[model samples]
Target: MTEVSKITLIGHSGWGPVEEAYEERLTVSAAEVTYRYHPIKATAENVAHRWRYWTDGPALVNAFENLAAVVSTW
Candidate 1:
């Protein structure tokens, strides 16, 4: 059997339904999907800070590094 690839889903807290459906579809391909929800207001500064934190923070950086792809809904 082929090994499943892991992917990261990053988006706002409001995208729960969309994420759920996408995750369900990805299951057919045996993908190991994970989600990271950010509830910050939709402002340029907030978005930039969020991305910088996710990409630079030790824990998040490590987790993101292992992901095959990153799907951002922001």
Candidate 2:
């Protein structure tokens, strides 16, 4: 049996509309798409902190693992 490909998308809460539009265009793909939303403010400090948290958090780590698994099959 063949394994379905998967994709992960990480973005700020404010980009919901854009993300939705992008997702809509992906409807014909066989790949599974998963989204991870993070709250971020306009200030530089807030933006930096949120990005740091996202990159170091457990959820992102798992996402990387999932990505690695998919790449291994190619």
Candidate 3:
């Protein structure tokens, strides 16, 4: 059996506030974390096409790099 050591949860939404706090609000610590920064105005039509908002920019690259670095330690 493979025991899970660490995990990360990525979330997305259609819209949100102007700025969001990415800090964890839990009092306990564990091997899991979450991230939810994207908040685009999307609809069914948008979903039909590729997710260009985040895919075709440095944000994705930076996010990927950060994710990789975090996972590397787990």
Candidate 4:
């Protein structure tokens, strides 16, 4: 499996410390590409679509493409 270089926690202002604690537990920093994205509160079935709608879906795809390129090189 490809290594995870980024982690975006999905929540809102309500989940402030929850997000912080989650990041701390993971130990991945913003400088390292880990981030607190917290765009929307997704319904269980529509999480993916809602995320794509709320966040920049194209940018996410581009990031994945870049990661794929690096992994392929490896």
TM-score for each model: 0.20, 0.28, 0.28, 0.26
lDDT of 1 at 10: 38
lDDT of 4 by residue, 1-74 (tens): 65555544454344443323221112222233333332243344323222122344466556656765665565
Off by over 4 Å in 3: 1-54
The TM-score between candidate 4 and the true structure equals 0.26
Better TM-score candidate (1, 2):
2
Estimate candidate 2's alpha-carbon lDDT, on a 0 to 1 scale.
0.37
Worst 10 residues of 1 by lDDT: 22-31
lDDT of 1 by residue, 1-74 (tens): 33324443333333544323221112111222333333334343333222112233455544544442332222
lDDT of 3 by residue, 1-74 (tens): 34333344544433445243222221111322333333243343332221212234566555555655666667
Q: Over all chains combined, what TM-score does candidate 1 have?
A: 0.20
Model 2, residue 14: what's the lDDT? 34
- For every candidate in turn, the CA RMSD to the true structure comes to 11.8, 10.9, 11.9, 11.2
lDDT of the structure predicted as candidate 1: 0.32
Q: Assess each prediction's global lDDT (C-alpha) against the native.
A: 0.32, 0.37, 0.38, 0.40
lDDT tens per residue, model 2, 1-74: 45434343433333444323221111111223333323232343222221112234566556656765675577
> Best candidate per lDDT, number?
4
Alpha-carbon shift of residue 54 in model 3 (angstroms): 6.1
